[model samples]
Target: MHKEQEKVTDKNRFKSCMMKPDEEGNIYCPQGHAFTLEQRKESVKGRYPRTIQFYRNEHCEGCPLRSQCTRSKHGRTLQRTDKLAEMQIEIRENLMTETGQELMKQRSI
Candidate 1:
């Protein structure tokens, strides 16, 4: 019973993430989908885990556009109040690390 419930929940979450905007004032997913804010609210209601991992090592390790992304010398920094903010920060920080600097150097080469 528990496993079944978990599967249902996972399915709902997957649906929510893929939601997009529709012609009405509502959100839709890419496949001509539609989801009401109420449904979205209920779906996401919980003490959800923080999805953003804001560590220096992780940030320094995998940024492709580091140089043109930040003004910080040590590395780029990021702050997020939402889920996508972390990804945005990660991309920005990648543009400002030593590795990013090297990439910049290579670009100039």
Candidate 2:
């Protein structure tokens, strides 16, 4: 694989093991560190305007996995945009299916 692809795969592998927000919008890490919504902003321009929410957990300060998690001095922050996240989720679901796999193979060729 290319270097960029390997880097993305490595990041994804770690992200799969990290915390994800629940349906109610609550996010807690594996160690039970609660994340708070830090900021919300609307995109100025895109195919469609989107509202993004940024969440961070202050508890990541002295965690052993800090280096593996993030390089930020403050803490780890997760950002999600309304329409983009939903669209990406849909695309990810489609990419997991047989048809999508075939399409990807054709594209690769």
lDDT of each: 0.41, 0.73
Query: Please, what are the lDDT tens digits per residue for candidate 2 over residues 7-109?
Result: 4443553363345568897887655778898999987785767788888879988898778777889988788776866776798789779998899899899
Q: What stretches of model 1 exceed 4 Å from their correct place?
A: 1-81
C-alpha lDDT of candidate 1 relative to the true structure:
0.41
Tens digit per residue, CA lDDT, model 1, 24-93 = 6454332333333221211233775554323121243244544433345554433223466446558657
Question: lDDT, candidate 2, residue 72?
Answer: 84
Clashes of 1: 7
Which candidate number would show the highest lDDT if scored against the true structure? 2
Report how far off residue 12 is in candidate 2 (Å). Answer: 5.6
Stretches of candidate 2 exceeding 4 Å from the true structure: 1-18
Alpha-carbon deviation at 95 in model 2, angstroms: 3.0
